[model samples]
Target: MLEIITSSALPVRHGFFTRKGGASSGVFAGLNCGTGSSDQTEIVAINRARVAEAMGVDAGALAAVHQVHSADVVTVVGPTADRPRADALVTAAPGVALSVLTADCQPVLLADPQARVIGAAHAGWRGALDGVLEATLDAMEAAGARRDRIRAVIGPSISQPAYEVGQEFFDAFLAEDRDNHRFFTHSPAGRYLFDLPSYGLHRLRSAGVGHAEWTGHCTYRDSERFFSYRRTTHAGEADYGRLISAIRL
Candidate 1:
């Protein structure tokens, strides 16, 4: 069985899928839905098909982007073969599930059930700093969703304890806003430990979302349930699986 995390805040049918009960093997084991990975194409397709079935949509109805870690958000109306170079996707069309893939990055799912609009975003630190969450909200609004009525839930990601950063990384966030310093702490390694989920929540709240939350699951800490790029690198692995999170109206 698949282990899918959900938030009651979102009234739409959605889930934050973990790396479990998949057809993948080796380094890309367990629900590795990333098409960009070196995993067997057929296995990845099977995993994605399972997710689509869980979402009550056909495999072709699962819409996703190429995910360039940018602030770009695509307004999807129907399923397409083309995966655009974007980080987020929003849709008001029913039966079309908006999805995003992540290994350690944030997979944010947003919805305004009253308006029947939903969105999914891939937000790593770079993408979050670039305003991907805000961009998704803007796209949802354009699709007839209200920010005041929207509920945003950030799925499993690298938490502060496992997300050590360099001085340059801290400087980039500080360059954006000195207040961003609050999201970091001095690490025992003399570096910084950045709080990605907290920053995500801050951004969502600042954008006037009615509700925002993180599922409090850390990908790096739970190797059995999640795939972490940083952990894979630390373990000297070639590649890691990607967790898929989706939302549908």
Candidate 2:
């Protein structure tokens, strides 16, 4: 069975799918839906199709993007002819499921049910710091959603404890804004641990969104349930799987 996480704030047909019930094997076992991974293309398609079925949509109706880790957002009208090179997707039309693939990055789902608009985003540190979450809201508003009426939930991602960074990473965030210091804490190893989800929520709240929250799932820590790029790298694994999150109007 598939274990999907749903948020009360988003009263729509949506889910943050865990790495459960899939066809891939070995390190890519359990719902590895990333088409970009080295995992067999056919297997990735099968996993994505499973996710579509769970979301009550045709396999073709599940729309996603190339995810270049930019702040770009695309507005979807129907089944995509081509997945655009972007990090986020928004739609007002029903039946079109918006999705984002991530390993340790945040798979953010946003909705304004009152306006029938929904958005899904892939927020890695670069994309989040570059304004992908706020850009998602901007696109939703353009699609007739109200900022104050929107609710966004960030799904499984690396937590601070598992995310160790060098001085340059810390300096980069501090350069962006000094207040970013609060999101970082020194570790016993003398490195900084970055709180990715907390930083994501801070951006969402600062953008004036009505509600936002992290699901409190640490992908790096929970190896059995979620995929983690960092964990994969740490283990010297060849490749990693990407978790899928979706929201449909």
Candidate 3:
């Protein structure tokens, strides 16, 4: 009953899970898998368990990190006591699911089935600019994945039409690289709209990955199907749910 979005480019078992078919209620309604949220811990666990089931892995085999939004990537050797404070995970181990939690931020899944390597990452603007995507590729290569065979698919994210940012945000990107200007456009409100997915794809492609794509589902625009941090803030909600995406080798 879970709404899972997948891409044909990745031969491995992976899914970009939607905020549907979950046990949460109130503001964190429908599949809030983030344990750091105000939602009940047991409920979040149940949601994650469902994801693990969908990925055909044990609950403990679904590995994730604390997600500090940096370029950090962790290579999953096996189950660990502490979730390393990182935003990405890679694994060559079969039966282990690399998962990332996101709300509007990009949930990127990468796979190179021939090399038996897979990776999942949580990429926000800061994380993307900091090279999280490239870092993930590096970690996967370290785990035996071949860059040319790896396909990266970006899941639900806030599209440019819905992502209005101030001049400062625009300036931040420009400061990083002048080419970053191409990812922004002037909105009707005299602000800038950033193309998050395009930027993500750009990063992935620039890193020399064989293929990169976006699901084209805008998280902020699809309330019933996704969890959007910006949407929740726009509605003045107390808290927002987090969506989960996973990949297994």
User: How does model 1 fare in lDDT?
Assistant: 0.94
| Candidate 3 lDDT, 51-147, residue by residue in tens | 9999898898889899899999999888654698999999888878889999999999999988989999999999999999999999999888899
Worst 10 residues of 3 by lDDT: 75-84
lDDT of 1 by residue, 2-75 (tens): 98999989888999999998999998878999999999999999999999999999999999999998999999
lDDT-best of 1 and 3: 1
Residue 196 accuracy (lDDT) in model 1:
97
User: Candidate 2: lDDT over CA atoms?
Assistant: 0.94
Q: What TM-scores do the predictions have?
A: 0.99, 0.99, 0.98
Backbone clashes in candidate 3 total 0
Candidate 2 local lDDT, 33-94, one digit each (tens)? 99999999999999999999999899999999999999999999998658889999999988
